[model samples]
Target: MNVRWHNGPMRLLAPLRSGATYRGWVWLILGGALMMPFMLVGAIVYNWFHPEAGFEGALHPAVFAAVIPLTAAVSLLLPDREVERTAARRLLGAEFASPADDGTWNSRWRTGCWFTLHAVVGGALSGVTLGLVPFCAYLLIQGARAVLDMAPTGAYVGWLPDWGLLTGPGLLLALVYLVAAAAAGMRALAPGLLGQGAADRLAASRAETARLAARNRIARELHDSVGHALSVVVVQSEAASRLIEADPVFAARAMAAVGETARGALAELDAVIGALREDRDDARGPQKDLADLASLAAESGVEVDLRVTGDLASVGRLTSREAYRIVQEALTNVLRHADEPRASVLVDAGEEVAVAVASPAARRPRPRPGGRGLIGIAERAAVLGGTAEADWTAPTAAAPGTWTVRVALPKGTA
Candidate 1:
């Protein structure tokens, strides 16, 4: 490995001051601690079977070997990989793509392997840390006595050969480096064993795409159904208020139309919400198709000259529904933004279904850019392998001219 150090001694000793180093140490320490109960039980059982071997036998390699499989089994079977991942992310600083737990055999096996590695390595490092500190202290004391020509105080120091004063500091420095290396190794291993794999990432991506698609579908439904109803209501209510006294019969008819439009909008809204709740598979009633275009124009509360040609019944259900929505959105745009609330609609069902709506453009102000209704029309057509375009026609400096929307969709088999 090519290592880069910027500040020499300070850079070399940076891990000692870092909070991540201590947190990593705590994570390893917890792993060793978790294995203690199993090891203790194994030791107790070993002592019971062989009383002649005594307590010293409990510390034998056999006791540790038995506990390893037990810890591995527990880690594998427990449905707590999420918990492990959380701890690893917070304490050991492992970066995971997703925190969701995918209960797969491969995931469990990886968790088991990680558990084994953690327990074994942690226990060994803990033992080394415990032994090295006091040993380094002893070496420091003994080296100081030799350098000062002072007598050694402890009997344990009498057997060792005299060494220079630098031995203690050298060994202490080695211990620091050892701890830093162990922490680095644990961090490096965590992401692979505990983090999300290829399959998990792919699954997450597919789910996100599905969610976005559903949301877009709901938006289009609301914009078409509710928007058209509200536009009709606004126009009828305004007309009813104006003619209520002079033309009682006509005003009553307009008010009735307003009431009918509101009820229809409410029903459509309920269906949309019911489908969102997944209360029933058929919560949403049968979708509107191209056959409903005449009724839509009649109830639009505007003078709409609608023309239809060719065989409408031959259009497929999917294409018909999209074509209907495209027309509905176009009429809604005319009702809301046109200077005159009158439009001409044409539906040509030939090799491909063609729909067009034209109306006098608003003269006082132009429609804002990036309106959702127009975008939705284009999207609906594009989804059915079709095209949609809207622009001003016959414009001049004095007049804004006619605003027209045109859409064409492939006529699939019924």
Candidate 2:
């Protein structure tokens, strides 16, 4: 604990600054020692004198504790604030190029603890060991200083600080007192600063996990239930269209299939909604992947052209899921924003599977799904370590002016 305590200021003052080392910590503690004596002494003495001064002492320690760390803090804010920057960066997996508003406590509280640790240890050493040096030497040198200071004129001879074993030992004892005080003071001031940061990181993790689970559950339930029902309903409807002229009995069967499919979909949706009654942490969504997309498009009356090169069984869930989303989003874009009522989709799954959607441009469709689709595309690409691009293109004679959406997913989501 003591070593850990000292390291905080070490990190702040003279931390390893990237390729360089910062030895500013010694300066931070020593300088703080020299400057804070007045405030610390006054606070200590006042507390010793008055009962009401307890709160004053409490606030005073932060002020005193802040000084050394503050100096170190300035060094960090300097053109070379790189060491502490790297430490926090690694802790949070943050970017140095971007602003680090997150490591506030990492820099502040940890640093303050270090300064206090140094002061306490240094003061004790000064009192117990260094203090004895002067005391031991005092029998020889104690009275010598006054004698040396004695002037030819008796004016200076009358008044002088005692240069004796008495004063040396007293100063040493005072140093010891200050060290103990500093340690206790730091404990009072710096606890939970790091804990708070850790809590924030944990909260973010929990939140992200919860969000992911919720979204996955919704998606899986929709596909397994609503999506399957839609598939059955569409098939039955098509059968009815063909058979209505030939046989009313077969037509009735087709219409009944629609009702049963829709009911089944609703039942699945309800089952998912019921799962929310369990602990949120217990929620689990069955994994869905790219193998399911072709069926999804077909069920929705959208034509798809899928081409696979490399085996996808080697591909993991995260990559496969992201690729599925890319296809889903692309098709959504074509349905809602494409210039033509019909669109073409081609997915190539080699080392990379590229999904591109193409539609004629002259048939102006309603302006739609700009913000949400783009954000979802970017998010999917980011999650999969892939990328997506969309553009409006000038048409060739064979394929007149058209709009195209393309997404590329790598085998490895690095």
Candidate 3:
């Protein structure tokens, strides 16, 4: 282990370096100001028990001295501790390990215990500092007079420390250490009184996880819904351009389909954005399911063969939504990346719903390891206790090399 020079006198001088001394001064002054009312009340109570006063309820002087300061100190404990904790953070640079809130009365009572200890220690330090002032003043006068002569009527000098050459330097050093120790003592209790425990940390972690999950869900919704819409708009616009002069009526129909698709896409986008607003739970997702496959097939610019083999209505809402998204994403991929725009979708609904989309692969590129599309497909399936797979295979003479995405989700998941 390596030892550093700062651990030497720097440890003693730590308060001065970090401005803790200044903070301690502020804390002391603030605490004293707040304690004044309590102290005055205690004084009045003590005097109310005085012999000079004609009141029948009189207490002994010894009891008054013992009880008065303790009563004042206890009365101001909570607020005083809060002041000290703030000073530790601002002035002494205390770093908290975890969060603490407006805690319970039990925690406040614990803080009061800490404050009582502080009062006792701090009161003694204040008394020492006060006593030093008179001593220092007396020493200065004795040093200046130079002659150890008695007063005109006196035979001996008053009770003063035997003057030595190092006395001044020694007294100054003691004062410095007294202030430093007081500041250190206050900072030492900060973590015990102000830090959070294990339960608080766990709650904070859970909240953070919930927030991240909601953000991811919104991102996935936008990507699946809006991306599919944009892909439809692109393909329909291209098809319309090729057919407009040769078949005006069919071209006009395609353009109209584009407008409808755009409107639905905008609504889906609005729904997703609205979910992020204050009334999130009231915001509904875009209504979609395996039954929409026929309309989805119609919107595609190229040929689409969509087949359904099982009872679609038996599928619950969440599974149907996932199935719709899977096909939408697959068709979007076909339009965006495939050399040929034609594709096939198969829905086999049973105890588990299986969905598949196949299209000719793009000319040059293949799926990479971390494409968001494939990752999202896998995530959707996994969320419903299912699985997704994507692959590209060698070309067949009958058609071409194809890219396929498949997902299987358990039935009745909502």
| Per-residue lDDT of model 1, residues 266-358, tens digit only | 988988898678667565678889999888888888789999999999999899989988888888888888888899999999999999898
Clash-forming residue pairs, model 3 = none
TM-score of each: 0.76, 0.41, 0.74
In model 1, what lDDT does residue 400 have?
Answer: 60
lDDT of 2 by residue, 1-414 (tens): 999999887765442232221122232244345344634655676577677767586345454554445444443333332443343333322232322343464645454444444444444443344445555345224445655764233222222233443555555545444444443343344333222355556666788999886776566445534554665576668878999989989798768767765765676566667665553534544545777766556543344555545567766667777777666666555544555445677766677867787766764344454336555666667666788877776767776877777888777642
Clash count (model 1, backbone only):
0
Query: Candidate 2: which pairs clash?
Result: 9-114, 14-22, 14-25, 395-400
Off by over 4 Å in 3: 1-18, 28-121, 133-192, 283-286, 300-302, 362-371
Q: Write the per-residue lDDT of candidate 3 for residues 88-130, one digit (tens) a residue.
A: 5776566665345545554565566555545544544554555
| Runs in model 1 lying further than 4 Å from the true structure | 1-14, 17-19, 30-87, 93-109, 116-120, 143-149, 153-177, 362-370, 395-401
Decreasing TM-score order of the candidates: 1, 3, 2
Which candidate achieves the best TM-score against the true structure? Answer: 1
